[model samples]
Target: MIAIIADDLTGANDTGVQYKKNGYSTTVKIMNDNDVSSSMFKTSDVVVINTDTRPLSKKDAYDCVFKLAEKLNSVNNLEYIYKKVDSLMRGNPAPELEAILDSTDAEIAIVASAFPDNGRIVTDGTLLMPDNKHVDITNIFNTETKRKAVNVRLINVREGAESLKQYMEGQMENGADIFVFDTVSNEDLATISDAAMLIGKKKIFCGSAGLAKQLGRKKKAEQKYDGTVFIVVGSRNAATAHQVRMATETFKLPVVLVNSEEIIDGRYEKAVSESVEKAKEYYLNGNKVVIIAIDSLFEEYTVVLRATATENAKSLKVAESLGDIVKRLYEHIKPVTFVATGGDTAFQICNFLGSDGMELVDEIVPGVPIGILREGMADGSSMVTKSGGFGDEDTLVKVINYLMVNRK
Candidate 1:
């Protein structure tokens, strides 16, 4: 089995979905070092552990990763270890990578933080963002420890896997502990993967979903899930709002707009019951999808309502209220598929449903991950999660289509 260590839940699912799309049974454990069980590694071909260390200090992140890596390296069936870093290099990747290298038998680390589809590319050792801004490689490893790294330019990568392997070997001999490859496209990532395969397993791979897609093992199998999908959109991001609007308007799906004020006023039970009734009516009426979203998330009235509550209470009340709606829907209709927009909304829904984590399956779009609830009342139920600000207007439409095609 292959193991992936990630800093966040979305990163874990997005990377794990690469293997799942290749027909591997993959599970993402939102677990800590101590909560980790043997069953996580034994039950799936690929397991992704969400260490959730992005917000942690370098020392804390390093210690967490080192201990986990040390324990995982001893797993008899562990084939490979992939360190999943943020595509935009937002986290303490350098320390986490170093920790893995220190704890495992890996002598060198191959680093590639480019996801071209997401408009992130490493060019001449600098990261190019979607907005065309540039970030230097050195700035990413901003910790006190200055690690030695070399960038395999685009020209070197295009020269073929053998040529790249020879260049990497030369650098390894010259005391470079990390090789960061410059990639402008998916083809470049594939070339890097070939080189890594040729070089052997004494090295650890650290990258985003881009590299994971190329390195993942594909077994070609079929997975079929059935039922209409329930979408809960709690993000105030304009992008998500537009997508939801497009999907509901174009497809003529029923939408229930949550009264944020009612929820905050402690009428969540009434809100949940009313929303469930509407959702159940739509389901019985033969609608393939139902959307539950906050009433006018982009409107000024909603903003004012949010501001009226304390910062912490605002998020807590809204997230819990949305979670309650999802829970009630589950109890009322038993919908096998659910889609959640916004990270807090997703986490709260899982919490309310008694889930420890999710079993990742596939992606509806580039960064939109689809998985199944794990170890809860909603266990084995399909779920799709999207970052509020990620995806285009048609992303929800694509999700709807994907569910229709893959549903049992």
Candidate 2:
């Protein structure tokens, strides 16, 4: 059985869903679950454990993963273990990685957290965001523990699996505990995965969903939407704002921006009704893609001037209002697919649509996972969920085009 160990619940779910999409009998279990036995591993092809250690102290995180890794290493049916880190290097990664190394027979951990489809890549051992902003990997991890890392440059990775394997073996011989690879695409991650397999039991894979997806590829084949692609952007992220602008101005998609300020103040009924009407009009007028997004213009001003008590309260209310609009839109027209950006927005919309969960399918891009509503009015309908800060300016256009191309 394949194992994925993640920091939190969402991280575990997303990674486990990748294996599920690839036709694996996947199960995501909490780390403290009593039934995480060999029988559970025997029945499933992949088992993901959520350690819930992101907010813990470094020592606590290490202890948590260490105990879990020890139990996993004791299991005989285990094929390989994947340590899932955040793409952005959030939480206590360094300590958790070290704990895995300490517990398992694996001598070196290979780290490649690049999800190029979401515009996150590693260059020269540095993590780069979608906007091409450089993020230092070492600094993001807990400063309490020092991470000893060796860089496997893109040049080395491009030289094929054998060469990459040889370099990693040499690094291991030289006392390198962790190997951080430079990757700018999914193919690069595949290469790294190949090299790790070539190295065999002496090593463990450590990365984000990008590397985990490559591991899933070994189990199954490489792998959409229809009708009007309804998009809801409730993110205040600047990256999403640029994407919305690109979709409207460049792709000529129609967008109706809702008054977020009014939504938070509970006076958004009129605005929500108008937005819904405009969205339906766009769909009926031969527009394949229609968007209902929270107005970004009022985000900053409203947060500072409004008496919402806290930004969290304001965000929740806005999400609720957006969900209400989407719920009402379903009354008029049933779009072939639903695209939701922002976690809160997506959750609220799904809750409003009567869905408790999303069935794992495939990704429109690397990080942007497309699923189906598990139990709702839109049950079995195509749905895509994206992080607010993920993707480029043309990301939404790519998503729409992907849905169009894959429509059945």
Candidate 3:
């Protein structure tokens, strides 16, 4: 079994889908502060555990990865382990990589955080822009936060992994933790993978989705569909609310703003049924996208916030209610694509559908990826899970248009 330690749920699914597409039965666990149970995972193959530690401090991130790697190592048949960092290098990856190396038997840590498809590349051991501009990897880490003292060095991929490994060993003699590997294209990815596989000694790998995608990738069957796309707003953000309003008014999409007050007042079942039926009314009449947002129907979001004692509790209830609505909608018509905003909301819907981890195929906007449901509902159904705070105005329009254009 292979264990992947990811920093977030979306990153977990994106990397796990790489293995799943290549014929490995992979499952992604939204890990938290809980007991790591064998029954909670698919023991026969790959398991990607999401630590959800992007927002955590360096020390906390390190502890989380160290504990998770230690707990998962108890399971036999461990093929390999990798730390899935943010492709754009947003999280506390340095410490997490260090933690994995500290806890596991891995001696060398090789990192490749570039995906050329997304225009991220590594040139001369530093991240490069699509336009060949060098990105100062140190700037993001050095000034943003206080990081642990480790050997922050890189290896030129042109020299090959054998040389890189030798460099790592030399640095290890000096107490080095990890070495960032250079990769400019798919060929570079293959070279790195080949080098890692040939290494006689055990080592940890630290990389982004690009490396994972290349390690075990297979072509998916062509999407076969002419279907509607459902957009469910499960997170509260002023930007998303603006985009939702834009899409509804400009595209004339039907809006089904769920009443959060009713949901909080012991009226969930009826609220879900009514919302689904109303959305279906427009959906059956040929509308492609239906907006399901809470509090927008009866009151503004600020009013809802003022009424609720705990904002998180309200969001959780609304997320579940929206999930119930989507589950009911699936009974009537399976959407070609489902856009679920917010992490908890997406997780709830995915758990309800009994889906295997997501297979990331494309992206609608920056930091927002669209992936296929590996197991649940239909074979080609696509899902877009976005955090509530990301994306700009017209982001929803761009998302829906992208879905419509690619709704195969």
Best by TM-score: 1
Residue 219, candidate 1: alpha-carbon lDDT? 50
Give a tens-digit lDDT track for model 3, residues 1-408.
677888876677656666656666666666744646455455436777878676567788888888988876665667678888765566677778767767777766667777665567765456754234465554433343343223233344557768755655566677644556657777777677777777677767677767877676574533433577778887666657887888888798888878777998889988988898998998878887778877653234431211233655666788789878887888788755788876666776776676645655554565466776756665457788765545677788888777776655
Top-down TM-score ranking: 1, 2, 3
- In candidate 3, where is summed lDDT lowest over 10 consecutive residues? 298-307
Residues 220-287 of candidate 2 have per-residue lDDT tens digits of 32334567788898877777787888888877888888987777777778878888888888888998
TM-score of 3: 0.66
Off by over 4 Å in 1: 32-39, 142-145, 216-221, 236-238, 257-287, 294-321
lDDT of 2 at 107: 71
Q: Could you tell me which 10 consecutive residues in candidate 1 have the lowest summed lDDT?
A: 300-309
Which residue pairs does candidate 3 place in steric collision?
225-408
The local distance difference test score of each candidate is 0.80, 0.74, 0.68
Task: Output candidate 2 Cα RMSD.
Answer: 5.8
TM-score of each: 0.83, 0.70, 0.66
Clashes of each: 2, 0, 1
User: Which candidate do you rate higher for lDDT, 1 or 3?
Assistant: 1
